[model samples]
Target: MTLNRQWLLKARPHGMIGPDNFEYTETPIPQIGDGEVLVKNQYLSFDPTQRNWMVDRPGYLPPVGIGEVMRAGSVAEVVESKHPDFKPGEQVQTTGCWQDFAVVAPGQGPMGVNKLPPGVSPEMMLSILGITGMTAYFGLLDHGQPEDGETVLVSGAAGATGSVVGQIAKLKGCRTIGIAGGEKKCAWLTDVAKFDGAIDYKSEDVSERIGALCPNKWDIFFDNVAGPILEAALNHLNLYSRVVMCGGIANYNNIEPVPGPNNLMNIVTNRGRMQGFIILDYLPRAMEAIEALVGWVSAGDIVYEVDIQEGFDNIPSTLQRLYTGENFGKQLLRI
Candidate 1:
């Protein structure tokens, strides 16, 4: 019998998640019931949203209760199947938790297990073609609504979603500015991702730089790292600007209540629209976004990067990179 190694949530995180928050153990691989399939997990996705799932609170999906498998999206190859819908040798994507194997059932909806398309590598499906890409695509186009020659600014700009948002804005004929930490990330944004400007938020004065770079103010602000950066962007929103509220990695680990942006009055003053979105809300239209993204990637109109960590043992420490800004591009684990 295959031994399944799993990470169980041992305690709710008090601040930043630590090794003590999770307990790893080995057990027999789960047997598939009548409609279930057994998947051998190969890649585990590390996302900022997983932090929210760790807290015991209501979210788009219910929080992972204590002692449950640490919830995560993963790509797996089906090794055994009792379900008619799944076949052996097929690769699938699902919330496989932090484990070597997963037992999955279909019809979970929005967040269900499904077969990966042919020719799409596991890394591509998890990064640019997966939830990360979809979030950037729909959030920027549907909500940001950037126009030709308009200035679009994105926080967490070197990350998986934010990077894509900047590129998509550029493709739409908008001038793009990316806000990221460190000179290296900023350079990657302007030099590699091809954004019009890149701000090193860690080293430079963000509001002052925004004032200088975008004298007309930003037409769209796709905010992923919410904190001071959100406030800074809010202070410079142009008339009818749209703010797409994505992940808030800066505040995800805060034990104490964080304050709202003091400059939110700019939203009222400029008649700007700020909206938060859960990507699951756009699931029905995911195929539309996927087709466009695939086409863009195919034609060299879009590019992406992935940071792959090697060991399953490093999952906890790897996740902390999201909060610490140590991770560049889309963070993933090769199990």
Candidate 2:
């Protein structure tokens, strides 16, 4: 506990990320300044967007500098506080990075620092009620603007964000169809998450399945996996449909830039709208999403999965799960 163990970005990734992309070392536990707090990260969040953050390019946030701690979201316990609003032993969520300890302050970093609500576990705060949940809530309801009886399609539908998107669409009286990787995930989507139908993109013809599933065409496409899947969804857009661009995990590891969907004209022809969003833009109104999500989850209307990998040694390898389809849901590392 005297030193902070960290995974630093060693080199920018070329294709798929691996252990070599990061360097591990120990440093003195960071000291907190006045109005800052020192937190011991208990869990680390692994996200597809982290791949984008690793590249040396302009993004919503700055890339992790070489030899610097790799940035990540985490649920942590306050170990020491120089800030008046925080106290020791309280659990909070913040941009704790890939380190055992971090110095954080209120209204700092992309996530900033917020206390976990009463009766909310760290896992719940990081997964269903965290970034992914918020993304699903705002992306589908706010951006997609789904209506009753509309056919709602979701890509990456078994992942943290997409699963919730489909469920919320269902709650809003939309017919939900999910596109996931394998039979296992697709089954979970239809059987457990209660989607109207599911398309296993790995085994089935996605465009054909969409046609079968949405006989009337889809009204909203909440896309998390863009690439060929995006093109497929675009092919089946209903008139004046909405496409919520959330994540593009399909091409995140590509060495060369992947081509955009060739069928984007479908949007224009159908008079549809496609909009991309960054969850950070809605952070100020986070509680709005959290409140609604908590109600659904408590009432069993929404169900989410979290894949927790243990031990600090497994940190780098655990992240590879997101791109490799090894993770079933929200990927987190227990420190």
Candidate 3:
């Protein structure tokens, strides 16, 4: 393609982000500089955190400036290379944003360009072995510090990261309970993901369900949906429990700051620890998660889902699916 089609940030969101937040444009396919590689994006990744990046504020990464390509992660093919480490036709993962082509270099961008490991497909690299998977591996193991025989609770349990977290906890011999939004997801958590129990937050009373399902209380709460759910989980924590503050998708689209869990004192009383982390902090140790995840997935111990939407025209609408919980797993767009 001679022109690079892109979705540029048109306006900051007030509530839920939608098509109006972006403007479509075409530009010359980006040229690579010396020591850089030019890549054609094949797939785009959509994450709730992208909402945080749209606002003009301080964050782990800078906000995507207005009229700039909307920041995103992508699996791309090396179309031309000026760098020695990459060559034409090799598939790679990089911060390709929402454009048809990008100029990338090793050690540049949040996710510095990396060739996909041999035998790993773009789906695998962007899902179970990508940022979401790495987040689950490190967030649960490093922050949650779960022990065998413990009872683990996961919020947003049907999502790409939370689902993997619960499965890993099960592999470690923990009895896992997942809190999701609908019956279908709840059923998938128990039937497919093999959690000990599932809570449908939309159809059931979350606090009461937690009390019933986790009669022994929980040792670790891997929370992705923070808000009322966090408050509910706090009601049933074992002594010295851990709360892995992963993402707060429940409030990501709020125009104003949502109130935090009113029962944070529960952490103090139970001698529990609640900690938050950005996956970028663990990028240096990414292969540690990747290697282990590959083993588990190959052995059938771990399973992940990717909800892919097609067409460049669907890009903005595809992102809207995340906030509305229309996506079943990892949200991706195939161009």
lDDT of 1 by residue, 57-167 (tens): 888888888988898999999999989989999999887889998888886634678788778899998999888999999999999987999999999999999999999
Candidate 3 structure quality by residue, lDDT tens digits, 41-139: 999999889999999999989999999999999999999999999999999999999999999999999999999999999988999999999999999
**Order of models, best lDDT first:** 2, 3, 1
Predicted structure 3, TM vs. truth: 0.99
Cα lDDT of model 2 overall? Answer: 0.95
TM-score of each: 0.98, 0.99, 0.99
Angstrom error of the Cα, residue 42, model 3: value is 0.3
What's model 1's lDDT at 250? 88
- On the 0 to 100 scale, the lDDT of residue 166 in model 2 is 95
lDDT of residue 324 for candidate 3: 91
User: Candidate 3 — what's its lDDT?
Assistant: 0.95
Query: What lDDT would each prediction earn against the true structure?
Result: 0.90, 0.95, 0.95
Off by over 4 Å in 1: none
Please, what are the lDDT tens digits per residue for candidate 2 over residues 1-335?
A: 57899999999999999999999999998778899999999999999999999999999999888888999999999999999999999999999999999999998899889999999999999999999999999999999998999999999999999999999999999999999999899999999999999999999999999999999999999999999999999989999999999999999999999999999898899999999999999998999999999999999999999999999889999999999999999999999
